[model samples]
Target: MTEFDRRKFPPPEDEAMLPWYRGIFDCGFISLHPFFVIEGLDPRLNEHGTLVLEGKDRPAGADFIKWMDQLSAEHSKGKELHGRSVDHMAKRFGQMIGWGEMCERLGLEDHCELDAALRTHIKGLRDDLTDPEAADRMVRHCAANRIFLPVEGDIPPLFEAKLAAMFRRAGFTEIIAGDEFGDDECIVPVIGLDNEKPWITRDDFPTYGHLRLMAPDHSMLAWVHWDSFYTAIFATKERAASLDLDTTFEGFWCAEETKTFWLTQRPLPLVQPR
Candidate 1:
């Protein structure tokens, strides 16, 4: 059976803005057709009542939700309106009048416009999914907030090489590069570990404590989730501060148990290779 390798399927060009679109989609503001089409994958509910792609044994719904939650948490960081966190405000308004109406009242018209453009682009009606104005806005937003988006193009060989070297420096010997997946081209940089066990029954997830690196823009991100801990290490302090780490951790519903460390102040840990 052919397994679905997430590393091989990189994120769409608009990865930085996908969470808002996905949140809108989840709220019934847009159809899932463009989302799946833009992602280059077709997923459906299997007989086991799990969302899966054809020929893949793994259930993908959990991973999809994880990705969404992580990105959405990051997207909401440092964004505020009327002295309330945008995420908090959204949730409150969503609960009262519903998400669709909340978006309408909040003037989130750009999301709908962007979704329409993506659908049109996929159908070959436009040369690009993003307009110059929107692109500029995204760039400025990321810059001002110190948010990092994946670089445009194939993952840089040098960046991957550097990540491998970092793992080696941390005393890992059985490093294996896992398939790239996610809109951010997240890849497991380490794989083999002593006494390793599957984190879950899903075949696509790593069976060992591994380090995953997402695509780099101004900074690189190495995420580790094992032993009931979820830690994300960024290449720079500014980048680390860009995210509301507490809020991000809370999104996992493990704030009380998870211990996060910023790489800017501490040495990276050497876990069994991914």
Candidate 2:
């Protein structure tokens, strides 16, 4: 796992989610699909009384993610479907999304293009979801969100110590470390990118990092949450807003989606292990 790269971006003091994401971009997590997708074999409407997908009987966003993830599942039975790749669709719709444009830029263009098979598949899937006449071909997780932010860098003794202290003081319910958990989940104060390979690397992150959050919305929420969700933990939004954003942001990145905007957005890492 990589240590938080403080020199590349902002510190962990910002209240808005934007700065945190910026920090992640500095580490190299590219936004492929702005929307996290999910697919469910069974479907049900939610409290929103809207279309729903089947799952482990969890949050609405989970259903949405399941619905969208089927980039190929829509063609399972008597169906044929396709659409843009998750990463490609994410980049294409980056304009409508908040931090997506930034995420797109930070990622490398190598694997960032619309994939061939996945591309064709998503196009069909999108159309089906857009206009579903039957049931089984139902797509669920269609909520758009920015999830991944790869972190790379040597650990800074000072920053590491500070965050370790913070987590220790918070007495979180969970802690994590190492590749399995760290690479997939854990949040970091700083993240670095392998712009050359265009993949995210991790210094510290682990499974069961409780700081990892899901999107607040169900159907309108993100798919995997991609270790990139945050809000004012305790402080009110106003209180969080009063705080500085620059001090915590990671800044611009070279995105793979578009040649125009710079990518930015990072995860807030978990300092301890569970």
Query: Which candidate tops TM-score?
Result: 2
Off by over 4 Å in 2: 1-52, 55-72, 75-93, 96-203, 208-210, 213-230, 233-242, 245-274
TM-score between candidate 2 and the true structure = 0.21
TM-score of candidate 1 relative to the true fold: 0.20
Kindly give the number of clashing pairs for every candidate. 11, 69
**Per-residue lDDT for 25-103 in model 1, tens only?**
1110001110101121111110111111222533566576666556545544543232222222222221111212322
